[model samples]
Target: MKPLALTFLSASIIALTACGGGDDNAENLTTEQVLSLARNTNSANQNYPDSATNELLMKTPEAVTYYLGDGVLRWSTETQIPLYFVSIDGANPPQTLIDGVAQLESRLGDIFTDFKLLTWDVQQYRDTNASDENMGNDTFDKAFFMAQNNLSEGGMILSIDSGYYDKQYSNNAQNMCANSSIAPFSGALQILWDKTGYTYSKENLIWTNMGNNHGCKWNTQTVMHELAHGMGMYQHFEPQFGSWSDGAFDVLATLYHNAPGTKWADLQVSTL
Candidate 1:
């Protein structure tokens, strides 16, 4: 766990030469006291409960209909979840990269049986906020970034960072493949693609010189993995799924039922 990044608004008070104009109660408290009171009031209003979808999952039985993001927890026949690709590096993603994501969209039905491929609407954009090149690595920084750049509700962001001297990913000469975070307040998930050049092979899902390999093995699979994290499959290991299995075995394990061939279902209920 790292330190949370927070932007504290500076509290100030102007001394008035005339004493009778201000409210008597405000005059009694110091500037620090006033700020403390305001922050306490705000904190008291926050609800710590998990999102509704998460609550339902906790109380309901295992089902094939579960989803991975806080906003897009369950796919609806009537509506599609909006998925946005944000270029935090300020470089527009090439067509090959875009095509890879499209392929994933095509395969969602096969991957998630009850989920409809049509339930997700997709788009790409150059981020209006700071690029990944300048963003901080902590949870609060990531949360603030999403708050500034995210476009809509039930919307997920796939962010691309320029991977240069990133404190979280690029330390010790390492390149982060990708990372993700969910907003505690909103349950929206943001997937961060870091470092490694954006160069990709002509074929879809193959990134040359990117994310720990030239091919970026199972590019779609990796996206699904990170998306699962955003959706609340927070655990990092499972004996049935493999050492570093993304807990896909728990909820959507049926999709890959034969692989690793362990009869495990819904790690969410069992573990959490």
Candidate 2:
């Protein structure tokens, strides 16, 4: 979400391990079978949305996306996961974050295709803190972002290169709001560069961190990952959703769930 369009965070650090919880041989099955299950997104007919409602749908993210192997985005009423972002690095609007949002917007059509992403500015709570001169040039207030965004208990916020750890703000990113749950969305975080730059993680984001070579596809992954979070799949391809490890099948996987040499991951989960 910061100015730098290309990003580098960590994803491989948390190698997702599959337990015997879902299927015993599910892991050992041929790539084809796995691909099929992952692509499924319940292709049931969605009632024609009213023109007014459809106009609004054009603004929000989708449960499934065309770029995500042809799955439509879906959400259940009971589950409302909100993600907020705090920009502290003087980055009013993160270009990289914008690119990611746009990539998804492209595939889903002009409706939600080009919706304006969420963003807002806020200041630290403590009046003295906000006005303090010696608090260093690295002052940040996560609580303000939360309150501005109406963050709830389970709500999440994305860090658009807020320079969180530049000083004491590291803890701020760790805890977006007071007692609120927050997670970082980043990619492969190399140590040396991070020391000179910023730390990144793949858990919170889905973008590929190829250093100087991040854009388009890199941003695409971010869109997929963030949107998945918007849905209900919080973890990366967890086995809890029976035969749902396939990214295309599960809202979480998306682009990262593809095979090494394949152009686009197979998202035909039990094709309807």
Most accurate candidate by lDDT: 2
Show model 2 residue runs off by greater than 4 Å. Answer: 1-85, 89-92, 109-145, 148-156, 162-220, 234-272
For residue 124, model 2's alpha carbon misses the true position, in angstroms, by 8.9
TM-score, one value per model: 0.34, 0.31
Per residue, candidate 1 scores C-alpha lDDT tens digits across 186-252 of 1122222111211111111110111221112224444444443332233332231111232332333
lDDT of 2 by residue, 30-144 (tens): 4464454334322111232344344433542221111122332222122222334444443433565556545543443222222223354322311234331112132333355
Clashes of each: 3, 24
lDDT of each: 0.28, 0.29
Residue 95, candidate 2: C-alpha displacement in angstroms = 2.6
Candidate 2: lDDT over CA atoms? 0.29
